[model samples]
Target chain A: MSRVIQIAGLRYRYPDGTQALDGIDFHLNSGESVALFGANGSGKTTFVLHLNGLLRGEGSIEICGMRLADGTLEQIRSKVGVVFQDSDEQLFMPTVLEDVAFGPLNLGLSPDDALTRARTVLKRVGMAHAFERAPYHLSAGEKKRVAIAGVLAMDPEILVLDEPTTFLDPPTRRDLLSLLRSLPQAKVVVTHDANLARALTSRAVFFDQGRITGQGDVIEIIQRFHWEYS
Target chain B: MHHLVIDRWSRGSSSLHQRDPRAKLAALLVFLVVLSTTRPGAQWAFVAYAVLLILTANLARLPILGLASRAALVLPFSATFALLTWWSGDSLRALALAEKSFLSGTAALLLVGTTPLTGWTAALESWRVPRMLILVIQFVYRYLFVIAEQVQRMRWAALCRGPKQRGFRLAAGLVGVLFARSWQRADGIYHAMLARGFRGRFVPAPPAPFRSSDALFLSTCLAGCLAIRMLL
Candidate 1:
């Protein structure tokens, strides 16, 4: 498959003189699923923000053969389906159906088309009955599913997840991992769930001090890190 | 903690419920402005406003009785001001305050009764409302239930520990706990948005195709109301 993302010499600094990312390089191919592992404050979240240009970074990053630009951020956003870790912040709509339909409608789909797509994605996520339910009434698992549906309505080529599993009940976490594993888009999961990483990903990129310190097959990378520590 | 079985009309069905939310919003706003602009003792206008409110309530299938209780909720605060007018021997001013307060409540009740929460949001989206603003409203509406749920759970937990004879006294820690839990819940949602490539802008509300009937109804009602206020 063709390369879906290319990041070269990426460096990012916050306004407070804190460098969030330091000279990093990474690439992801279409259909690949990669785990981006790191400790807290390790720039994992910052790097994911750069994917959709929610946060600006220095140097070069290209998505789907198009060089990302300020003017084209919205277009790039539509193409990269991201499921934020916070389902509450992601689902900022009064009802489930409207929340899911948001992305497609923004992309200029007709109301009927957008609602149909929302229904399809919600059903796919096993949430067909929650069309009118408030996001607040939903359990954590349900909220996460609805958030995923919101992104799925966009049908992005690359789904970039920021800590896809967090604070979820074990069953919900497993279900979410399975759901992420099932999507066809290339994935970059920023997660601390070792089991989740092992079960869902084929490749691993060890992120440290704002850069990729190691990249290889999942087992090799996990084995290397485990052996070094043990 | 929130009760599940709140009054239905405050959250129910009628032809008013079926109308476009933007129309309902505009109608309510115009009606409120007209009612407020009237002289304090424009007795004729007050009767006209009350008549219009009742007619709309009938159309919206709302309970006329509950309108008073709902009106009462807004009355106490404004009553103090009305009391001042009464104390100053301005019975006319007092009457005006009373009329304005009741009419304002009537206008709001009609608006919310006619418009479901979701439809109001969809209307805002179709109007090219800023994504962030729409998202704020969406999040507030969705999580209002979540906050209610959290409070309910905490109250249940408190009751489990406290004796029945103790009465319904809220614990100091309960507020802190509820806020913390909701905060954490909010954190999870924010992270989910980031994962899915949410860049602060919310998904826009879908706009339904405008039917001729909708246009006709909106124009006639609005025009008639305007003529009554301005010309008559």
Candidate 2:
């Protein structure tokens, strides 16, 4: 399998002088899914943000064979879709359809074509009935679904989801896991849910204080870290 | 929740709602200008303006009382200036000041009540309003609910700890924490935007075609405002 993401010697420090991501190396093969397991402040989110050039850290990062640079920023972003932890933050457009169309519109799709793509993806995610609805009006599950649809509309090669099941009930979480499992893109999921990691990912990486502490098969990583609450 | 109500109202199927946003915006401009220039002692003109707004609200199938009550939110701000005028021995001007402000608020609310945010903001974009200003407005409107919810949660947490913790100190602490949370949320939102390939400017959707009915609507509004100003 071809590598979709490759990172070497990656490090980031916040403006306030906090070391968020220490020197790290990681890679994801095409169609492979990896779960990032870490504590709240363990740099999981900071590391994933670098995949799409959202954060400018000191690193040699490549996406789908394209080196991270100013000119390749847009192309790289289009390749790596990041679904944020907070659905409210991600779904910023006035209506569900408009929000879903946002990425395509940015990627230079014509409004008509963009709206059509948005509709198809919304239907794919089973949110077809919420096209005209405001984002604030949606239930948590529906909002999560629409957020996923927004990213899917772009048709990225890699999906980076941070805590995708944050506010979901068990049934909603199960539905999301099934939907996520069906997607073909390579994924880097930053989550605390061991069950989700076990169910969706083949590999797992553990982070501690801005460094990778462990990496291996998903179940083994979970077992090694004592990740789940008893 | 109040904004949510306005949001739902904006999606109505009335003729006013169906009218092009540009047309309604033009009508709102005309009404504001005419009402602002009306003479202070012409109380009848103010009454006429109020009646005209009520009639438009009726035509739009909106609850007039709801519109009036929400519009009255502007009264306290205008009341201070109105009081100054009253203290300056121009009671007529003070009353007219309040009347003009109230009527203007109602008229503005009418346009937004009938036109969805995307519709009206798109109209503003077409009119060459600064893209940055529009972005700020859109962001503020979108995140207001999130911020409000945060405030409620924080307040609830505080109340859970101690019911007596209700005063300036608690309120001040809440504001400080809320500001920090909002800052973090803003950063997340900007990152989300960039991850979705947002460049410096937002990509606007293509504007809808303005039909002949839209032009007719603008003309009718212009004529009504002019007639009221000249005759009443």
Candidate 3:
């Protein structure tokens, strides 16, 4: 019913004069799951970084039509949960419980509340038994689950996942995809996997060389990209 | 996997390994202080101290040699002989000093090797150590092994293909990389800790408390130490 995230004329270039994003306009509706499909260096990571105010570009980003600003950055981040591509980088804490507790703790939840939320999310991700295990001691699939739980504990309404299935074995990937599909939030996913994009979202946008190539059904883009390239 | 560092030191079945870390730490420190305060080799006194340390180690099932080697690793190049030559006093004093230091080191190793790092940290909390100090110690102890492992892995990886000298540079660069990685890692950990609402005090896991046997064993050891220091 409402545009939860809106962007227009977003242009960003690295200081070394390499352009990463150019004239990007995108919007995410409330409770919509959208997939951003692109090949390598298609500026997907840069775009998601802007969502959480981790980067700045020439374009505007409006969450529920509010402009990104100093006060709003934290609010935007709190509302928009982002799981980075590398679970290794994301799950850097000593123990699973501690990592899961981090975001809520930052939000100033009491220790018991933080522990409660942490335990709940860990159980949701099927990692309840891994509460005391260190990050380096986990399997890749388990680490990814822990990372997602870390974000889930924050209770964000919008989830942005960057390449969630990378490095996972087939079974682990399937589990992760199923988990993603089950989340009730509005999701904007950036991935190179076409079938995953088709399986997870009703809407799809193709990005290439710093600009949008087309926007339509994921199956259509998949067929179109293959046809044009072949 | 119960990969406790304490187990690395011993396989002993003694109740000392299961004792409260706070009591052990306090006792060990007191023993070390008394030994240090004593003038060099009082043979009878030194023998008694050595027997105490060895007895503790034996009971804890810790490898005395492994602990001793580790303790001696921090020694300067000039050791027993150098002390013998350098000391203005008699050779007995030199021997005594070395023996005393060795006993102190053994006591420390026995304490640490028997107690889990987390348990020892909780013991610090029990002793009213400042929260910030405990946090700092915890972080340093937790990451030290991580950083070491990373550095070793990096070196090994580089050594497989590169020249030895080149590998050294790469490994040194890895050390620098580790510094950056650890800083980033520390930031992530700090945030993760903050998110989890970790304010300060370490959460102590209450293992089974002291049994009658543990008290009797500690009391016997305590009595022996007092007797050795006072009587002999």
Candidate 4:
């Protein structure tokens, strides 16, 4: 498989001197799905943020063979779609259609085309009925679907989902997992759900205090980290 | 919750709601200017303005009572100044002061109540309003509910801990924590925007074409307001 993302010696420090990410190396092949397992504040989120140039750390990073630099930032962003854990943060437009259209509109698509793409993706995510609904008015599951639709509307090559199932209930989580599995793009999922990781990803990477502690088969990594409770 | 009601009202399919936003905005400006300049003693003009607003609200299919009550939100502020004027021995002027403020508020509400936020905001953009100011308005409107919900949850959590939590001290602490949480949310929102390839300015949706009916609507409003100013 061809490499879709490559990073070397990645390190990031917040303004308050917190070493959020420290010398991390990671890679994801095209069409591959990987799960990131870590305790809260273990730098999984920070690492994925660098994949799309949202959080630039001191490192050499590449997305779809394009260097993550100033000139290539926009292009790289269009290649790596990040669905934030909080759907509220991502779905900021007044209506569902507009929120989903936001990314396509940003990519210089004409309004009509963007709206068309948004509608198509919303339909794909089973949120076609919510086209005119306010994002805040939707239930958590619906909001999550719309959030995914928003990212999907961008037609990115790689999907970086940060806690995609954060607030979803059992049936909603099952629906989400199925919807996610249907997408064709490679994925980097930052999650804590062991079953989710096992079901959705072939490989897993564990982070500890801003560094990778283990990387292997999904079940192996989960077992090594004692990531699940009986 | 009032805004939510208005939001729902704005999405209705009445003739008044179908009027172009630019026409509605211009009509609002003309109404406000005419009402503001009407002499304080012209009680008939004030009555006419109220009738006009009521007629328009009915035409828009909005709940007249809801619109009136929401518009009365401005009265408390105007009543303070009206009280001063009344104490200064000009009760008519005091009444007109309150009248002008209420009429103006209702007229403005009529515009927004009929036109969705995007419609009017896009109208403002077409008029060459400062992009920065429009951006601020859009962002605040979009996130106001999210922040309000957060505050509600925080308040509930505090109340759950103890009944004595309903005081200025608790409010102050909530405000502080809210400020910090809002800050973090803002950061997350900005990052999300970046992830979607937002380059400084928002990509505006294409503006709707202004039709001849919209022109006629604006003309009717202009004539009505001016005639009221001269005759009443």
Candidate 5:
């Protein structure tokens, strides 16, 4: 299987000298979905931030076989789309359509083409009705969908979603899961919800103290780690 | 939440709303210039300006009372200067100070009410307004709702825990927390932008072509205001 993402000896230290990520090794195969399970501050976010070169540290990272570096950061960014946990943070444009088009436009698509792609992706995510709606007026679920559509509009090869279901109700989560499942890109989901990991990801990797402690089938990892609360 | 009312107002289909933002912005500049330069004690000019704004507000289909009340928000600030002017014995200038500020505020609100935030900001960009300033304005406008909601939720939580009279201390604490939250939120927003291939600048959607209709609208507004400024 072709590897979409590969990292070795990944390490990151905050300005305050705390090691956020330490000597990590990971890989994601093409068309595979993996769940990143860890407690808060277990370097899950910091690691994902590295995938797009948003937070660089001591690491050798490659996306689709291209080594990540300053010169290739922009190209890597377009290849690994990240959906932030907070939809408010993700959807900053005045209108939903503009917000969705933001990524495509930034990727250098012509304005007409970007907008057309944005509308198409918005429809794909069932947000076409809110094309002109101010993003602030959307409900949490709707905002998350728009956020995903914004990333999808870039036509990225991989999606890194950090708590995509944070504020969603059960129905919304189900809908989001289905929408996510329909997408063809490889995915790395940082989640605390074991059921979500099981439902959406084929494999799971557990993190503790900035190190991967285990990697295996989703149900086995969840069961071994007791990831769910009664 | 109250600002949402204006946001909704901007989405309307009135003739004024349909005018290009550049035209509306140009007209607004002219109105401000004429209003600001009017001679002291030119009560008739001020009257004409107020009437013009009211008529424009009517054309935009915005509720007159709502627009007036929201515009009155500027009064407390201007009223201070107006009061000092009155105390120093320039009652005419004082009254004009108050009237000018109110009318100015109303005119500005008309522009925002008629044009969506993106529309007006994009117009500002076309006029060569600094990209950083436009970016800041867009972010502030977009996050105002998010921050306001945070404030509301915090207020509710504070109320749930204690007496409302002790809100001063609660408010102080709220401000600190809100600042920290806003900082974190801004960081997240920047990261999200970066992850999506943003390289410092927002790629503005292609602006609609500026048409003769827009120019005609600006001309009519300018002539009408100029006529009122001189002829009134």
Candidate 6:
């Protein structure tokens, strides 16, 4: 299987001298899903941010065989769709349809084509009825669906979902989990939900103090890191 | 909440709402100019301006009383200047000052109440407004609801401690915290945008074609306002 992402010797430090990421090596095969397990401030997010060039650090990273560089940044971004932890941040357009169309429009699709693609993905996410509704007016689950639709409209090859199930009720989380599992793209899920990790990902990587400490089966990593509350 | 009401009103199907945003924008400019230049003591002109706004609101199928109450929000600010003029013995100008401000607010509200944010913002873009300024306006309009909700949640959390805990200190502290949160939220939003191939500029949707009917609408509005200013 071809690898969609490859990273080596990745290191990052904030402007305030805080070391956020240290010597990380990671890879994801096409059609594979991995769970990223880490405590707050352990560099899980900073590491993923590097995959799309949102945060640049001294690292060797390749997305879809293209090196992460200024010239390839835009193309790399189109390949790696990051669903942020907060749906509020991801869905900023005035209406749900427009928000979903945002990524496609940014990809240079004509407005008519963008809207059509938006409708298709919104339907895929089961949010077809809310095309005209404002993002703020949606419930937590609905917002997440629209956020996913927005990213999906870009037709990205790999998905990076950060805390996708946050702030959702049990039923909503269940629905979102199913919706996510049904997508065909390779995914790297940054989450605290052990059940979600087990259900959606076959492999897992554990991070501690800005480095990957362990990687193996999902259950093994969870047990090694003591990542669950109960 | 004010924006919520206007947003709902803007979605309603009416002839006035169906008129193009550029047309409404053009009419608003004409009304403002005519109203502002009227003689201070020409009470009849003020009355005629109010009537014109009322007629427009009626045609738009909006609630006149609700619009008037919301537009009255500008009164306290304008009343300050009006009171100074009244104290200086220029009662005519004071009355006119209050009248103009109220009419202006109502007229502005009429345009917004009939046109969606996308429509008006697109109109501004088509008029060659600075891209940065239009972007700022769009972001502010989009996030105001989120900020308002956060403020309410913070207020509730504060009130849970004790009803009597409210004071200037508490208010100031709330504002500070809100400011910090907003900054963080803005950063997250920017990152999200970047993650989706945002290249530092927003690509607007295809422009809605302005029809000849819209031009007729604009001409009629300008002519009516001019006639009111000249003859009344």
RMSD of each: 6.8, 2.7, 5.4, 2.2, 2.6, 2.5
TM-score of chain A in every predicted structure: 0.95, 0.98, 0.95, 0.98, 0.98, 0.98
- Write model 3 residue lDDT over B57-118, tens digit each, in one string: 77777777777776784355336554755576567765765676667767777877877555
TM-score per candidate: 0.69, 0.90, 0.74, 0.93, 0.91, 0.91
Pick the TM-score winner: 4
Model 2 residue B49 CA deviation in Å: 3.2
Colliding residue pairs in candidate 6: none
lDDT of 3 by residue, A1-230 (tens): 88899999999999999899999999988889888878888888778878867678887899866698877766666777888776766775456787787777767777778889999999999998988776766888998899899988888878888888888999989998898888898999888787778778888888888898899877887887872333
Docking class of 3: incorrect
Worst 10 residues of 6 chain A by lDDT: A128-137
Question: Candidate 3 has what TM-score?
Answer: 0.74
- Candidate 2: global Cα-lDDT? 0.92
TM-score of 4: 0.93
- Displacement of residue A47 (Cα, Å) in model 6 is 1.2
Q: Please list the residue runs of candidate 4 whose C-alpha ends up more than 4 Å from where it truly belongs after superposition.
A: B165-171
Write the residue-wise lDDT of candidate 5 on A1-230 in tens digits: 89999999999999999999989999999999999999999999999989999899997999999999989999999999999898888888889998998898888999999999999999999998999999888999999999999999989999999988887899988999999999999999999998888888999999999999999999999999999977
Which lDDT tens digits does candidate 2 get at residues B1-232? 6888898899999998999999999999999999989999997778888888989999899999999999999999899999999999999999998999999999999998999888899999999999888888888888888889888999899999999989998899899999999999888888888888898778788889999999998998898888889998
lDDT of 1 by residue, B9-87 (tens): 5356576777778877767777877777777666776777788778888877777877767777778877988899899
Model 1 stretches with alpha carbons more than 4 Å out: A56-62, A67-75, A93-95, A106-112, A132-137, A217-230, B1-11, B22-67, B90-96, B117-232
Model 3 stretches with alpha carbons more than 4 Å out? A64-67, A195-199, A226-230, B1-28, B43-98, B110-157, B160-228
Q: What is the interface RMSD of each candidate, in Å?
A: 3.9, 0.9, 5.2, 1.1, 1.0, 1.0
Among incorrect, acceptable, medium and high, the docking class of model 1 is: acceptable
lDDT of 4 by residue, B107-223 (tens): 999998999888898899999999788888878998998899898899889989997868888799899999999999999999999989899878887889999999999999999
Q: List DockQ, one per candidate, in order.
A: 0.28, 0.74, 0.18, 0.76, 0.76, 0.72
Candidate models: Cα lDDT each: 0.77, 0.92, 0.75, 0.91, 0.91, 0.92
